[model samples]
Target: MFCNKMLELQRVYRQASLLALITIYYNLLEGAVSVWFGAGDETISLFGFGIDSFVEVISGVGIWHMVRRLGRGETADRDPFERQALRITGGAFYLLTAGLIATASASLFQGHQPQTTRWGIVISLISIVSMQALIHFKTKVGTALNSPAILADAACTRTCLRLSVVLLAASLGFQLTGIGSLDAVGSLIIAVLSFWEGREAFEKARGLGCGCSCGCTTSTKSDH
Candidate 1:
């Protein structure tokens, strides 16, 4: 049983590492594409895709921090304060999501169609799948490990999965209905969802002793 558990941890760690590396590379590629297609084409979807890539990059960085903490045998020693900080960061990430959605909506209203390059839809699909996998793994780790940072990471991936739904809508609406407004409306919906997630993250962080003295400087058990 002990061996099995150890193997599971090793597997999870490997998966996390793969995700971190890929997300960073993906962000660079996406940002370049978005910038190149910024004008005279998809002013919103392309730009929004770039923004989403950055968000993933942030998540990758956060995960890297947590991974190092785990390596140093410090995860177990993390305090409530650190946990609250993670929550705050999570809240900020979602708030940025709201801003991205707003920008996407505004662009759509201005009738901006993404140039539909070879990479846009394909990469988006791959990202959607990757995020879903991350969400599942992170949520499980957070619950078992009692790690707020892990939980927040899971939540961000969940948000990404939800936003991908809107992207799918944009694809379909463009192909079927030919109504550009559908894409705009989808962006609005995603923005509203982002706001809700942001508020949720803030509340969760507060519950973990944010803006209060909970003496979060010490942990007896392992955070991993």
Candidate 2:
């Protein structure tokens, strides 16, 4: 029975690692396209959103590394490595928040109106669908694996979904109403949320004495 359980865990960890890699690839493509169009069209919101995608790619990599350790039969609560990974993910989120804020503020100050680009709208719609599906699968796998890092990774994807909605709204609004400031405003909102998420991750890391992702203080807690 013990051997069966270990095999099951190994299988799930492999799946989680594959999902993380897929996320990295998707975000890389998405970020490249977004940055290209965003820069060409001078859309601050779109550019900031692209930058966020790249940051998410880093977070995915961190999670993938941690899960791979588990796949190698390493203990999940290994303090040195797990804590380092958590801190890396947390710091990346904070950096993303700062970048978004700075970009949005500069755009607002300059009164730079984002030119309507149909590509922004299309990309955001695709992101919404893709992120939602990822959220579902990540949630399932994270729960089965009982991994806090993986679950936190899923939460990040949820934030990406929200950002996509904001991007779509800003893009469509600019296209229809010709309002330039709305794009900056959307980016500002995303910045605030990113900061909040970063803070939450940091707090979780600090509270994790056992280095498990879920923050259970005792062995009685489910490590599933």
Candidate 3:
């Protein structure tokens, strides 16, 4: 029975590592493309979305390291690193929220109209489909593995899905209506959501329960 448990855990770790690597590569590509097109078109929402992707890369790499540590049987050394990652994730979100607010405000007030980019639509569509797939698989794996960190990471991925929706709506709205301010409005929404997520992540890291309905981070055991 002990041997069987060890094997099961090893399998979970392997799966986690694979998922983390996929996330890293996907985010890097998505971030690069979004940033490129967002800058070219001066769309605050796409630019912010691109920044979020890069932040997710950091998160994915952190998860990869945690999984590797688990594989190496170094469970005792994981808590501090997990805490730090949570803190960093929270901090990044706060910064992103602030930037989005400033940029969105400027766009709104300065009559900064954005041109429609074919790439924004393409990126948002790809992200929506891809992130949804990832959330499904990652949530399944995390539940099966009984890992809080993996579950938290899955939750984070869900937020990405929401962001993709906002991006798509903003991009499509602008493309269809020619209302350039729609992009800025969408960016403000993203900022509000990001701020909420950041506060939750930061609270969970401090052992203050994330307030998620799932109670995923109610305990001080671990977080992502």
Best candidate, lDDT-wise? 3
lDDT of each: 0.55, 0.74, 0.77
Question: TM-score, each model?
Answer: 0.62, 0.81, 0.86
Q: Worst ten-residue run, lDDT, model 1?
A: 210-219
Better of 1 and 2 by lDDT: 2
Q: Which candidate's TM-score is highest?
A: 3
For model 1 the local lDDT of residue 144 reads 61
lDDT of 3 at 182: 91
Off by over 4 Å in 1: 1-15, 38-40, 76-120, 132-152, 200-224
Which 10 successive residues of model 3 have the least lDDT summed?
211-220
CA displacement after TM-score superposition, residue 189 of candidate 1 (Å):
2.7
Kindly indicate the candidate among 1 and 3 with the higher lDDT: 3
**Residues 105-170, model 2: lDDT tens digits:** 888898889767577799999999999998888879888987665676677677788889988998
- Give one digit per residue, the lDDT tens place, for model 1 in 97-196: 7776767657666775545433435545766887777667766765665555545556556666766666666655665666666556655665565555
Tens-place lDDT digits, model 3, residues 172-222: 998988998999998999888878777876775565753221124533233
Candidate 3 yields a Cα-based lDDT of: 0.77
- Alpha carbon deviation, residue 200, candidate 1 (Å): 4.8
